[model samples]
Structure formats: structure tokens, C-alpha cells
Target chain A: MDATPQMTCQTAREAFPEFLDFRTAPTARMAERSHLAVCPDCQREFATLTRIATALDEAPSALPSGRMRQRFYAMLEEEKHSARSIHLAAEREHHARGLSLWRRLGLPLAGCALLAAGFVGGTRFSARSPESQDHSDPEARRQLADLQQRVNAMGQLVGYSLIQQRHSPTVDRLQGVLTSASRENPPPQVINELISALALDPSAHVRLSALDGLAAHLEQEVVRAGVLACLAREENPLVQVSMIDLLATARDASARPAIEKLSTNVTTDRNVRDAARRALAQL
Target chain B: MLAVRDGELNALGELFERHHGRLYGFLLKLTGDRSTAEDLTQTVFQRMLKYRHTYRDQGNFAAWMYHLARRCTADHVRRSSAAPRPIDPADLNLHADDAPHAAGQASVHDDHRLLYAALALLDRDDREVLLLSRFQELSFAEIAGILECSVGAAKVRAHRALRELRDAFFRLQRPTPPVS
Candidate 1:
């Protein structure tokens, strides 16, 4: 009953590796023939392997049905559309996040600039006597301060402009307030007007609240020519500041003189005039 | 015909025309129920289109299909809810045609019925491996993917299934003793 009696005829398991692949290795084929010649047990195993390979070779391939094909194609198209919609939604969310971050950091600087603009743009403020101006209604000034604070935190002013456009704020009302005081000059009105409208506005610079809107208007040729013809003779430092901003991007032949006047140390303070001179040269 | 792969309905219809009768015959032998086997074979190809991406060119395509058939057969046993199921036979046939010269076997109607019953008694896993290898003759490696097991495991399971078949055959041949 000992199974050891059958061990002598047991085939080497080595034929297995070759049998895994249907292709017979030459050595395996020779080995298989030799093993089968002497070993009945191995012959059965070999025969079984061969039988399996042949049967599988005879087995049929799977084929899909008509209705199922239609469903799959529809699903793939739907997936592609969904992917694009998801991508666009994600892009807008990212842009919104950047605007939010700017508002978080720009508020304090905006407050200081609001004060600086009201006083006027230069060191000439320190030289002024305290009694020179009339006491004004503080309400409008306060509103301006608050807006300046909001704009400061807004990061890049370009995005704030986009926000303003989205909100549809009253540019005409703001221009009206500046125009009423234009004969004398309103420092904050002029600069804010130039920032919001003249520089980037569709209107002419000559149409600005003051000659200072000239610099912003210069970004466009019609505005540039209007600003030069109307404000090139104005000596106001506030007006000159806009001129500098205008010259910053100007290639015009007429913008050179205003730029040079701002640069001369004799007319402007050393630093302001020095910066203006460099800007003029660059232009 | 629906092609679940890429919605190629025409291709699937063509494939069905080429393969249905041949596959139906094989399944008929495998299940011993002409109608059930035909339905199951149709469903298998429909499901094939569903999982066409799983097919790889590395092995014989037919072997892959048989691996699927093995799974489907095992599933049919496990569910046991398939309506119109064929009645159990006293024995089952493993092969529908002539046996190898070594066995000098001739398959007749009696042998075929016994073969079917003997096959039904096998555990689903062992039954699949045996049918795929011994009946369908798929290589062990292709069977491994369908079963998600190693090739060595497939071989051992196949060998075990064969031994079970041999035992079942022996049992059917024994005469039961009469009660006192």
C-alpha cells in the first residue's frame, strides 16, 4: 500500500514551466518526448497540458451586443462634457481666491494713501501753514477714507476695477463731484477720477476733472493729446503727478517737457524732481 | 448584439454570427441543458463587452473567454436560483465526444448523463478549474486571472477537481446494499 512504489515513475515537475506557455521550448519538447517515452505518469500530465491548450485554442471569443455599445458611447461623451464643466468652475474659484487674499493685505496702506492724497501729493504739505484751508464737511472725506482703505486691501488695483465694473458703480457721479471743484482743483477727486476713469477710461483726458487726469488719459492717444494740449502748462504738483504716471508708459514727443519739468531739481524737491527726471529720460 | 466595449454594435453582431453556434455547443456540453446553456452563453458575451478592457493580448483570447465561462458556471451553482434549471442526473459527462486513445473510451448517452451528475457534485471553485482546464482546456495562467489566483493554485485546484471527478465516478459505479 506504500505509495513509494509509484514514486519511481513520477514525472519531473520541470515540464510545467514550458507548459504554461503553449509554445514548446525546443529543449522542453525534447525533454517532454523523452520523459513521456519512459514515464506513463508524466505522459498523462503532458497529455493533459496538451489537451487544455488545444481546447482553449478551440474556445470562442466574447462579442458585445448592439444595445450595450450604444450605452457605452453615450456614457463616454457625457464624461467628457462633465470634465470640461468641472475645469471651468475650478478656474473661477481660483481667481476668486486670489482677489480675497489681496483684500486681506491692502487695507491699511489704502488708509494712509487716502490721507496723503487729500493733503496733496508732495512734501509741500509739511511747508504749509495750518490756517490755509477752510473747515470742510468731514462726511465726504470720511467716505473717501473708507473707500481708500477698501481699495488698499484689494491688492492689484486692476482687479478692484473689475470688481467696480461688476458692481456697476457710478463713475459719472464721482466725475460730477470732481468737476464742480475743477476750476480750483480737488486733489483726491482728480487722482481717484484719473485712476478709475481717465487712465483706463474711454473718455478724453482733457475731459478729466483737472489737467492731472492728463497723465492717465495718455495711456490712449486721444487722451494723451488732450492732456498735453490742456494741462502741459499747469504747474500744479498734483497735476504733475498724474503727468508722471502718464509718462511712465508714454512714447509721445509732447510728454517730454512736462516730464523734464518734474525732473529739474530747481522746480521740484530733489527726490521728486530726481524721480521725474529719470522717468522723463526713460520715456 | 450590444458591444459593451466601445458601443460597436455592428462588430458585436458580426462576432455573434461568427461565434454563437460554436460557443453554444460548448456550453450545451458544459451545462447539459440546451436552453439554459444557450441563454448563459449569450449573457456571457454581453458581459464580456461590459468588461472588454480586462482582455489582454498577452495570452490566447479564447483562453480568456473560457476563464469567464468557468466563472459564470461556478456562479450559476452558487446562486441556485436559476429558473428552468435542469434536473440532476445520476452522473455527468466531462466530454461529449470520443475519449482519448489511452482511455479507449466511447461516450454514449448513459456516459454523458453520468458525467453531468458527477460534475454537478463538484465544489464551484473546483468545478470551474476542472471544466476550464480538463473540459475547455484553458492554460492554467489564463484561468488564474479569471479566478484571481496564482497559476500554482490553479493547477492544484484543477488536480483536486479531477481527483473529485474520479471519486464521484467510482461512487456512482458502486452498488448500494439492500436494507434488511
Candidate 2:
């Protein structure tokens, strides 16, 4: 239509989308441009549209803070966990439906035979000394313990993944995971997750819970360094104070440099600075 | 997003990290409220989970997501009793703290403020059209799909919206007639 004089102001305006944005073909833009070149009203209108579009593109958009990310991840993790449980329940029902009654009965019968064999073996072994029992071998006990720890570590990893979800993890759920981590001979990975929570979890209380759970492990070099780094970067005064106290109680002299920095940091809260000073003296 | 649909929840976190900033920016501009935008960002992800089953594998995920975002804005408007108030100067000056090192920037900042004020005065539908077309940069077909209209109709609405926005902008800039 470059040759046609029939392109009306109305038609030009109707093609405003194509005119305002270059979403149209070059030929369409040529026609629109030719029309605008001859038409003042359409040209003025296009100029106004261009002005507004340019201003908006240059306008600064306010970004949501870390809190929003924390909340979204928490919600996602909860939903996933709920969905997984539902799937698991469905699978259990399917298994029940597929199993024959004879097969179901055979499982319990096998369990009884295993229990009876274990009882007979125990009696025969104990008739000699307890040390003579093959089941009492240190290697066997250690292997069983290692297996149990691995199983527990696997479970904790799942929990850790849920907590790691940047969306808002529930404080109680994290606390539950922390409590499990605090039990006898906690896995190293579980400890690592706790250290990470201390350093980076958005919620102050969650960080504090991590501190409480990890208190027993502070003697470990990595745990000490993580807590110190957390103290250095923590904006929350309460968490900082708690970290200081944990470090002092652990008698970690390595934390002295971080404590000195925080103590002398004029930007830090008065209470936090004072706490850091106290920690420095104690350490 | 495919991973999210397939029950890999952690994958959603990656998606959010990649997109939440832009998504939040869109919502912030639309609602003109930071907190509300944040709440709606969270709501969008929650809805993604709630409606994951409906996600068609072959569909455009961006289109589906923006459609959800559009619905979220509409739902929020419906739930609120009050109309969207004019954009606050303080809110519009989101980048005021940025040290404007150049002489030309002050005028640009003023222009930005004027445009936002003008945008706030437009009808919600008009603003939606302009935002989707300009800021969010959606194609007319995608806008049509989100708005539930034909492509021609979407174009018309966009044209009308742009006209109204231009009118409002000039009206704001047209200095108050010297007080009698």
C-alpha cells in the first residue's frame, strides 16, 4: 500500500500496535510511516505513544526483597512434600491391590521363620560366652551402625532439601530437622546444612535454632568458620549475639579476628558490638 | 517449569530465581504497591503448584504464567473494595537514591515521574493493555490470549489505551493554567 493514498488516519491508528512497537513487517511499517509523514494528527499521536513507551522502558522497577524468595520456596517445598506423600499412599494402595492373599500371608510366615532362626542362634551362641557370638563381632556392629547412619543421613538430606528451598520454610519443620541432627553422632552433611542455615537462612529464629543445634559441633573447624562468617555478615543483632556467645562458649580462639571486627564496627548495633567485645574477651 | 510440572519442586526455585525479579517488577508497576506485589508474586507460585496438573506440556509456559499473573491481578482488584489510588510520588521515586551523576538525568527522572503519574490516572484496563504491550513486552497474540479477545480487538484496545495514556500524560504536563 506504499503506492496507495487510501491509508486513512483511522487505519493508521488501528495499526498503532504495529506502529508503536516494531512487531509488524517492514512493508507494514513503511506504509504506516508514509501515512504518518503526510498526516500531522497521526504523527503527533505516534509521537505521544513513542514518548510514553520510551519513558516506561526507562523507568526503574522496584524488585521484591529476599523475604519474598524465602516465602515462595517454603510454599513450594510444602506442596511437593504433600504431593509426594499422596503419591506414596497411592502406591501403597496399588501394592495392596496387586498382591495375592497367598503372597501377603507368605511375607508374615517368612518373618516368623527369620525370628525363630534368630532366637535359636542367639540361644546357642549365648550358651558359650557372649564374646563367642558371631553377631557380637565389632565389625558387624560397626557395619550395622554405619548402615543406620546412612539411612538417617538420607532422611536428613530430604529434610535439608526442604529447608534449602528459598521459599519460606516453616520454623517448626526446620526445628524438627535440627532436633534430629542434634541427636547422638549426627551425620556430617546434616551438620553442614545446619551451618548453612545459620549463615544464610532469612529468619533470625531459624538461624538461632541452627545455632542451638550446632552448638555441640562447634569444635569442628568448618562449623567454627561458618559461624564466624555468619557473625560477620549477619544483620540481625540477636543472631549475631547468639553466634558470639556460641563462639565464646566453644573457646574458639580463631573467632577472635571476626569478633574484633564486629566489636569495632561502628555500623553494628550497640548491643551486638558489646556482645562481640564480651566474646572477644572470653575467647 | 517442566521439572516443576513433573514434581521436582526444587526446580521451581531455579525458575523463581531467574524470573521473580522481572515478575515482581511487572506486579509492582501494575499494583503500584511494593508489598502487594510481593504478596502476589508468592500467590502466583502457589497457584502454579495448585494448578500444575492443568499445565499442558506443549503450551507456552511464559504465556501460561503471564495468564496466571493477569488473573492474579484481576482477582486482587476484585477482592479489594477500593479502586487503585494514584501512584505515589515516593513510590514512583523508587530509584531516587541512585546518585544521578549526569546533568540530563534530573529531567529524565522528572519525566519518569510524570509518565508514572499519568499511567496511574488511566483506567485499569487501559493501564493493563499498555503495560502488557510495552513493559512486559508481550505479543498482541499473547495479549489477546491473556485478555480473552481476538487479535484485532487486542490491537484496538491497545491503540485506545495508548491514546488515553498519551492524553493523560500531556494533561499532567500541561502546566496548571495560571491561577486567575
Measured by DockQ, the strongest candidate is 2
* Interface DockQ per candidate: 0.02, 0.33
**What does candidate 1's lDDT look like per residue over B67-170, in tens digits?**
66666766775677543322233222224333334352344334444555666666656655666664344566777776789988877777666667656754
For candidate 2, write residues A117-217 as lDDT tens digits. Answer: 76567567565775645667886577557755655654565555545643433654475456645566667777777888878777777788888888877
Candidate 1 C-alpha lDDT tens digits along A141-211: 56556755644433234323332332222453344324432322223433444444433433343234433
Model 2 misplacement above 4 A:
A1-4, A94-283, B88-101
Per-candidate TM vs. native? 0.38, 0.57
Q: In candidate 1 chain A, where is summed lDDT lowest over 10 consecutive residues? A: A159-168
| Residue A77 lDDT in candidate 2 | 74
What C-alpha lDDT values do all the predictions have? 0.52, 0.75
True contacts kept of each: 0.00, 0.67
What lDDT is reached at residue A17 by model 2? 74
| Full-model lDDT, candidate 1 | 0.52
Question: Candidate 2 versus the native: TM-score?
Answer: 0.57
The lDDT leader among the candidates is 2
